[model samples]
Target: MSPTPEAVDLSQQRALADWLPGRLAAEQPAILVLGDVMLDGWWSGSIERLCREAPAPVVDVQNRESVPGGAANTAMNLAALGARVSVAGIIGTDDAGMDLRNQLVAAGIDVTYLLDHPDMVTTTKIRISSGGQVMLRIDDSARSVPAEALAELAASVRSAVEHQHAVMVCDYGTGVLADPVRRGLVDALAGRDRAEPGVRPLLVVDSHDPRPWAPLRPDLVTPNAQETARMLDLRLPEGQERVAEVSRHADALLEATGAGAVVVTLDRDGTVLLRPDGVTHRTWARPAAEKQASGAGDTFVAALTLARSAGLPLTASLDLAQAAADVVVHQPGTSVCSTAQLSRYLKAFADTALEAGELERQLELHRAQDQRIVLTNGCFDVLHSGHTRYLNQAKQLGDILVVALNSDESVRRLKGAGRPINAVADRAAVVAALSCVDYVTVFDTPTAAPLIRQLRPEVYAKGGDYTPEMLAETPAVEEYGGRVAILDYVADRSTTAVVNKIRDGEGAVQTN
Candidate 1:
């Protein structure tokens, strides 16, 4: 249960970010993500231009996009976290479903489980925004995959789990985790058929059911404070008694669910973690923006899976998740956190190419490396100690740290005119050249949420003043049992400072 090298964060603005890489180095055994597969779409533009054709502001159109949602997100996260992903979820035989499956395959997640049921409309959630402010939201998806499809999915997952390092059962409560199929998925991983004994395949379950938990006895189950309370049926407050009770409840819950360990995330208070090794701990998130929590939990649990698969102990796994979560929850829209983005908040690991031109290629190349992916994004205008510390720390979160830099266009849209002082290529290189960075790409969105969701790193990271509970990435990161948190800020170190000093020409400091 002790924190391993991967979880050790040199930045310590919050939790350890060192364990990420080693934790993600595992073979990324073919993971069977059996659950929801969805599409998350977003429309971004300016309110100033609403609809010129109507009385509404002429909303200047920026762009439209989509990524995996629900169980699919879980699958993508697994892939990002360095696991060879083979997802089994039903999608309609429509364009959206096709897009979802295609994206998963393109991102390196096996789509063997992505069933195309003609009766269903692929699950999708669309969010529209302008100038960093969310203006509207849309939901277009079904509650469940077809019954027959679910049964087939169960069989597919059962077979995949045989060869997988672990089977992640992502129950989003959205039809995907139907009681019947969900239970079957867990049992399959538990070696019910006496299939491949001694392998002790890990069963990672992320769901809203306390009753179902015990029946499956998964290796690990991640639940937020509120969800923990509901699942454990406790009214415990935040205190020693609460910790003890929560642990006991979690233990009982663990026993009931047959899970080996329980990691309960306590938002701002960091995380109240429990491990089978008889250890418990708490960690904090970095200080960051406090707005829409689109994809925090997904990032957190994703990090955990990656860390665990990479051989990181529970302590290191939790620590890495906390730090990664800190990085993701501070943005305005559905965001993402790449290993590179979180890398600044990680450790002084290895660096990767981050130029805009090389990003896509880098992504493809890394996708071929057979490693879990930890993704995070940011502007990184002027590199600073905090940034380096964060990057190095993030490297510990997964095997391959991919940083998503803001494209020149994205910078202009997000930071306003004259933004991204460092062009996409320059910014990418600056971040990529750092020993801590792995791979770098360009994202033209306000936040890395979308990219994080797509990349679905094992852990998502951010830098700021928030605790784990206070961390914005909490809910989303935890959704798929991923952990989230902020990295300790580098005290007074900041890119803004360097920028100011240089602008004044009275600065005595060095520039990257």
Candidate 2:
């Protein structure tokens, strides 16, 4: 039987967690971010009284911070994800522009193509908040870019696209990506050599109105529900209804945006990818706070673009992008997901204990990727340094490590009454929390022979110094051309010894 959607999602998430760190480390793809660039300002303070001038709360501004917004925010996120990023946009020669430029430079983004227009006012949005509630927002982006600035920006776009692996267009209905600029982008995309398969640079559009750039034939276009509604000129319902509506019009959206795929982001409901092949891939959103910072969509686009440029599958790239968006939604203000932060967030998926069926399905995926799987089983009643060392050693024997735990009933039957001071759930959670263990599952069987035979991992590891003939599971392993490995055992580190010592009150207990 085919795996369920939930099972597939779990398997994909696990694979991404294991694959991202290495993939990000090996390649630093160059990406060019083009479109409207703005400065986001946050002014937060305490509010104790109403303003005398108007019916509004008075905010005693205590702290003020500024960060990049719009297309520049996308560039910041790309840089944080370890991409060699360059930004092409028009910004006024004002203080906000200078601050945005300095921040982008400090973040290691190439700003050579950031054109400075003397007459235009740099786009800046400042939010005033007190006690976690936004009081008012002030915008300073009224002037339009002159013809001279637009010409310069168009030239810069043409030049920047030559060396980039991907171009991410972030259009907020701003004048920076004017007709001239878009023509330059389209001409540059058309001029690229396509003699070799997969040689053309990817074009990803994250615009409020994507129809204008349809001529460029973007590889991907990300539109939220509102933007999708605008494109279709139909008011969408809430929740799953909206998703269904978008799916029904997938062909129209594809044709309208001229994109190979369209990813419609449904906010808390997560995102869905629609393709011309009539295949739709959906990623459910992980748990996140209701109140999130701005620029999460920018983070998603940055990650999606980077992943695609790195040659990841479309579905996998969407999953990674959703993961990145999930990470930044929990922070305050405009935030970016760094490589280390994204890696850690992905690794957190390993903490979930899977059922035997799900575990087997996930193992199949790992095996198909040519990753050797190592299986080990034990009570793991009380996790300690000894158990950690053993698991680490087992992980070194293979590319993926699977730890099986004895259920409560099985633990009691094997170790007698008062055994397993910790329950099976607790045991599995603790073992899965270890970095060395990739997957954890519970079994009620008296022996692990059945699981070993079912999984047929490349190696079956045991911590004790026992010969293969002494183990019941050894035969099961050998029957399938799998080897049995014995890991190093730490003496005097048994769980029984620790429990006995605690019962005897022999050691000083530490308190938090």
Candidate 3:
């Protein structure tokens, strides 16, 4: 049996968080989003009384706004994440279609291929909400696109795919991606020599029912739990059981969807990625929020497509997609995870204390990126200017500076009683907050030799008048071809000196 899929290593998570923003900025991958396009309208107001005609609460509508939905939302998410995005689909020539087109243009998305059909009704969902809860939804959509309109969309998609780096098929069972469009997509993809490496436009399919598009042979397909269950014609149990059932049918799902891989997203249960070779990778969901917004799946697909198009490993792309989805779930309404928001979320991980294993994994990722690692250990019971200055100097020596703090027990063992004014957790937090420090971890050892050997940082830094002979970890560093560097120490900058001054009350004010 394949081993259980573990969460993405914390270090890798940190590395992806740091790498994605810069990569997206430099590449600005052009992605074509095709399939159903719609506008989502929100009518929010106060429900103070019941309506005379019915028992339902009467909503005094106070606000009305519209945003992209379905495939358009997916395109919006791609645009938000710094991708050069264009949308292709069928919409009506009505006001709703015009509104949707305007919104897409305003968000910097190219709508050249978003065709308007005189006979079709623009797919629009108007949801009435009150006090942050959805009350009712009214949908307007055409059952099918005219054959001529479908032909036009297929032609546009064929041409658009030629210039794009990635194509996202967001099929919502709206007939926008009809038989003609699907056939065109298959021909276009096949003509691109997709089997070869470094193809220009990778194809990703996100559909309500993906089995029909099996001929396209997409690189990735994202189907939520319910969608997966429907495709399989079986009821999947909740939680891990659902994940196991999906794993057992991984090969079947691959064959059914004709995708290189399938990611089955389980709301509040994270996601499970299934591949053709029986390899599965899972990402655990963040703690469930009391209430969450919608369209996180679209956010996931957008990030995943962008990451994959940028040549990130498939597993890493999955993790990045999960992180983006996590960002949007906590927000209200249909939301998108912007590049800045995702960066901030990932940076938050750096402030928390990591175990030795996690820290080592993080360092390995740094090494992979050819970044220099600097390691330093101390008992920062109280943060002061001296500590900050020393850390800044240490950071200057390398690309990533890791601060290791002595655990409370170790601090007390070394300094005797009444030492370590703050606990290791608190100390790690303070040290991590320093702009120069990239990561923080707690160590209980009397010396930092174990950590130095495990992390194998390029530079083992210390502050003060200490030579290689004075440090216990010098041999450990030298054994691994690493070097020890001593940074300049400011006068009267010791934590001991600060504690003594406080105890002596030298800086205390005299009361009248």
Q: Candidate 2's residue-wise lDDT over 1-512, tens digit each?
A: 12211122121233445656457645789999998999999999998888889987778899999999999999999999889999999888999999999999999999999989789789999999887777788998946778999998887676788868899999998788989999998777766654334567888999999999899899999999999999999999986577678899999999999999999998876787899988676655654655528988998889989887886667657767878888898888989999888888866764477888888999999888999999999988755446765776687678788999988899899988988776665566556644456789888887999988888999999997688889988889999899999887667677766566566756622210
Candidate 2 colliding pairs: none
lDDT tens digits by residue: candidate 3, 1-512: 11111211112223434656556646788899988998998889998899889899998999988889889989988888899998989999999999999999999999999999899999999899988888899999997779999998877666778768899999999888878999888777766656444664788999999898888778899999999999899999976689789989998899999999999998776788898776666655563466527788899899999887776667656667877888888887777888899878766664499889998998889899989999999998765556665776687677788998898999999988988776665566545644356789988988999989899999999998888899999999999899899988766666776566566755521110
lDDT tens per residue, model 1, 1-512: 23333223222222123334434634455667777667888778866444557676555668887877777766665666567778877788888988887888888877765777777778788877777666777888774557886676666656666667667777766776675676566667666447666776667887776457566667788877777777666676973345557777655766655677777766654566676555555454544655755667777877777767666656546666766677677754455566665656564323334445555555556668865566666778765545765775566565566777777887677667756565555565455544345577776655666555555566777766767676444566676666674666656766656666556765344311
**What ranking emerges by TM-score with the best candidate at the front?**
2, 3, 1
Which candidate comes out best when scored by lDDT? Answer: 2
lDDT of each structure?
0.64, 0.81, 0.80
Off by over 4 Å in 1: 1-23, 48-61, 190-193, 234-248, 275-278, 291-293, 330-332, 348-512
Clashes of 1: 119
Error of 2 at 351 (Å): 3.3
Compute the lDDT for candidate 3.
0.80
**Which should have the higher lDDT, number 2 or number 3?**
2
TM-score of each: 0.60, 0.69, 0.68
Off by over 4 Å in 2: 1-15, 194-198, 354-512
Q: Is candidate 1 or candidate 2 better by lDDT?
A: 2
Total colliding residue pairs, candidate 3: 0
